[model samples]
Target: MKILQAPFTEEMMRSLRVGDEVAINGVVYTGRDAVHKYLHEGGELPPGVNLRDGIIYHCGPVVMKEANGDWKVTAAGPTTSIREEPYQGQIIRDFGVRGVIGKGGMGDRTLAACAAHGCVYLHAIGGAAQVLAECVKRVRNVYLLEKFGSPEAIWELEVENFPAVVTMDSHGGSLHAEVLRHSQAALAERV
Candidate 1:
């Protein structure tokens, strides 16, 4: 329910079944697209940085300056997960990241990796960026600025009660696949 880091045990991940709503507390990293490519391509993360046993967030926030000109998140929703399909599984294994937060669903390869690695994929609500931003206490820091542009930069966030649902579990259960199968079968009956 409340965790600061990943590399969580298999029992912890399994206890959190697909569709179990959760509120996360503590630190997390934001990364997507270009970051994934760079990591998989053997480009080392800047020195002193390690994602091992951390949670990676698939998000690109809309940030704004406060009255004092300090940047604050305006909209901070999860990104479509399918884009990372190409690199996710390998990244997870290579980097030792134990959790991923994104919108929508990942593919079979990612699901398989989760099973192999005792990881979990969490899905945050798609259109609730502003609301989610409210939960972010502060933008602790950022990284990977040059290649990925600002959007692809990694944001270190401090959060409290940040809402999400478990969509994929370490046991090889996938809420996304289950939902799709049910939808397809229902459509077939109508046709």
Candidate 2:
């Protein structure tokens, strides 16, 4: 398994290819549809939040607040990624996002952005929220809690060995497209 650490750089992102298993050790921000739309329309990230060469996980985590006001993540599964296809490319370009973590996959526009911007799309396991939350080491900070609420808020998370697989690479490779092409060919033959 390839190890991806903090300060994820262009070279590191480019080195990853489709089907590569990776364990990410660093900070990843939780972003849902609300976050995507907000950023797409030029909304500012919470102060001190930057996406330059950073990873954005498409998740609406299940979080619980503890005494002393510390938050704990009870579930952290990946959300369907295709829904963000419209804004993903733009977000990747505009914010310099190096990696995206989500379930399923994205379309050509996002793939093109990854190719152009040295970014990669990492596919996390679906239906594995509780298991995935084990990788989260800390809940550093959260933003937009008032406007977007917990699920849709910007959650800054520190993680360790968060496992994922590269489904789309910066070199114009997409496992999702491959699956679609193969499925189409099989359907044509059957008909």
Candidate 3:
């Protein structure tokens, strides 16, 4: 298993390939469709949050507030990545994002973007919300909570040993596309 820390460099992204298991450490930001749309439409991010060479998580975590007024992530699972395909490529380029964590994979546009922009897409296990939450060590801050609500808000999180597999790579490798192609061929043969 490969270990990756935040503020990934271009060389780091290029070294990854589809099917590589990875353990991620450091900060990651959460954003779903609403947050992506907001950013794509020119919404300004909250100050002090950086995206350059950063990791973006396609998640809507269940959060709770502690008595000390600190937020805790309860359940954090990856959302379907395809839903953000339209904006993902652009966002990756615009923000210099190096890694994306989500489930269900993405499309050709995103694949091409990864190739061009030195980014990778990591696939998290679906239905493992609670297990994933264990990786989150702390919630640093949350943005757009009032406008987008808890799930859709931008959550800045510090994590340790977050597990994922590389499903798309900067070299234009995509396990999802290969699987789809094989599945389609098998269906045709059965017909």
Per-residue lDDT of candidate 1, residues 5-69 (tens digit):
33354566657778788787767888988888888889887764567767888999886668986
Top candidate (TM-score)? 3
Q: Which pairs, if any, clash in model 2?
A: none
| Clashing residue pairs in candidate 3 (N, C-alpha, C atoms within 3 angstroms) | none
Ten residues in sequence with the least summed lDDT for candidate 3: 4-13
| RMSD (CA, Å), each prediction | 2.1, 0.9, 0.7
Ranking by TM-score: 3, 2, 1
lDDT of 1: 0.83
Question: What's the CA error at residue 85 for candidate 1, in Å?
Answer: 0.8
Model 2 alpha-carbon miss at residue 116, Å? 0.5
TM-score of 3: 0.98
Model 1: CA > 4 A from native: 1-11, 65-69
The clash tally of candidate 2 reads: 0
Candidate 1, residue 112: the lDDT equals 94
TM-score of each: 0.91, 0.97, 0.98
Task: Evaluate all candidate structures by whole-model CA lDDT and list the values in order.
Answer: 0.83, 0.95, 0.95
Candidate 2 segments whose C-alpha is farther than 4 A from its true place: none
